[model samples]
Target: MKETVKTKRRSFKHLVPPVDLTGRIERSTRMDRTIHAVAKAVRRRLGPGRLRDLLHGVPTGKPLHPPLVTVSLGCWVATAVLDLTHADPRAARAVLTTGIATALPAAAAGITDWSSLHREQQRVGFVHAVANLTAVGLYAGSLALRLAGDDRRGRLLSFAALGAAGLGGQLGGHLAYRQAAGANHAESVAHLVPLGWHDLCELKDLPDGRPVARRLGYIDLFVLRVGEGVTVLADGCSHLAGPLHQGRLVSEDGSACVVCPWHGSTFRLSDGTVAHGPATAPQPSFETRIRRDGVLQVRPAPL
Candidate 1:
């Protein structure tokens, strides 16, 4: 008798293993060369100064991209609703044009922020920007159709554009929530410290004029000793978690500052306030006191 070979049945999961699409995109190495070149170009294009700062929301202590994106997306979505309801063609066209206009500034702010992120974040952000630009192009086509009196076709095209925009928005959400892009990385220090002063080190132990990393609880701190005074702030850079102790000390706007090594985000040494763009949020600072026993102690400064 001939023995039959057994064939194991394969289900969908067996045929195709589950994928972490976002993870894969973030971990991809294939795009590194292009990402570096493009990021450099974007930085060069945007340049440095107030324009970049305004776009980054440095003046307001928040990223302008989010609000600008909200307005642009809101207008586009409103236009689609108007079309479905058979609202006045003028109303539909008006909102569509407004969306197209607002998206320009939004794009500027977004790419400005993207250039300062880590390589992994930049990877996802590049795809996110592409999807958004595609949606904008589709919306432009829809607007042209509407202006040409092809109202029905325009409505259909707008709906398609909305789908593209939705995809882009989903990618953006991934960047914000999962990757923590534009989030203040050093904002958690206040809650982590216990009541009263925590011991850092003895006064004589810290070297003068040099920034050093110290730990308190689970938090890493940037500690600087100059003469008898001690300066302490959260070690994580507000922009991207680059160790502040690893940063270079400089004078910005005639004030003492430390420039983040990873992205050049400047934070004032006096109060941990930001002195440069690409980092809108201030680093959490702490008050220092020397105990009678010569041990340096620190506590969270009053907000």
Candidate 2:
């Protein structure tokens, strides 16, 4: 006769308490999905072509949201401090008004950037937006109370608004630093690829009128050939790290361009200028030439 023992299989679910944790997780996941879907719809209606570019600071070559947020939040913080310290009421009123006004554009820019992010990043951004909206409401209430000559309630509301704003600022920092929502996706390509010309491929290997992906050291390069000339740009789109090599080549406004596969950010081939975007930064372009040996070589262009 043999004795046999049965053992239970291990599962991570076992570590979870016997509470309603599953239900809570399901609800949170559903909300996140809803938020992501709503952001996608808003982005489509807003159009990521030109208007989004303006919001993203493509013309200025940096994210506009950061500076705008700094000013907006700075004013609110100053107002809160002034109120707490029994400083000039007129100055506090002025700052609160300015903060409210500045927050409008800052929120707009933030939403524009938020719309282009992936689902995980969008979830964080959604909470961030909600917090800021709450702060704005509190500040508005404070302003109205101040106008009604209720200094005590106004100061209290301002304090609450400051707390909400601080929470929102913390989330914004997470989005920028942890999730990299507004950072350049292809910034590393410049540093990774050597400055000198590196042989890409033979001229015949790259067909004319097609966007081909090539590797130069650790960087992926998008190569396009157009009638006796070759154009090379970083393959990673600046917005959300979309693959430009898989994008369509189109002539927009008489300039050769490539549109991002993920977000449709269009970049000019000649100089890597942003043609249309949710992408704030331009793609890094490389200078290309065909040597007598029929080898195509590319090098980082001067900034």
Judged by lDDT, which candidate is best? Answer: 1
Least accurate 10 contiguous residues by lDDT in model 1: 9-18
What do the candidate models score in CA lDDT, each in turn?
0.90, 0.85
Candidate 2 residue-pair clash tally: 0
lDDT of 1 by residue, 14-132 (tens): 65537877788899999889999999998998887889889899999999999999998999999988988999999999999999899999999999999999899999998889889
TM-score of each: 0.92, 0.88
User: Candidate 1 — which residues are off by over 4 angstroms?
Assistant: 1-19
Q: Write the per-residue lDDT of candidate 2 for residues 112-182, one digit (tens) a residue.
A: 88887877677777878889999999999999999999988998999998899987887788788877888
Error at 34, model 2, angstroms = 2.7
For residue 216, what is the lDDT in candidate 1? 92
lDDT of 2 at 222: 89
Worst 10 residues of 2 by lDDT: 20-29
Candidate 2 residue pairs in backbone clash: none
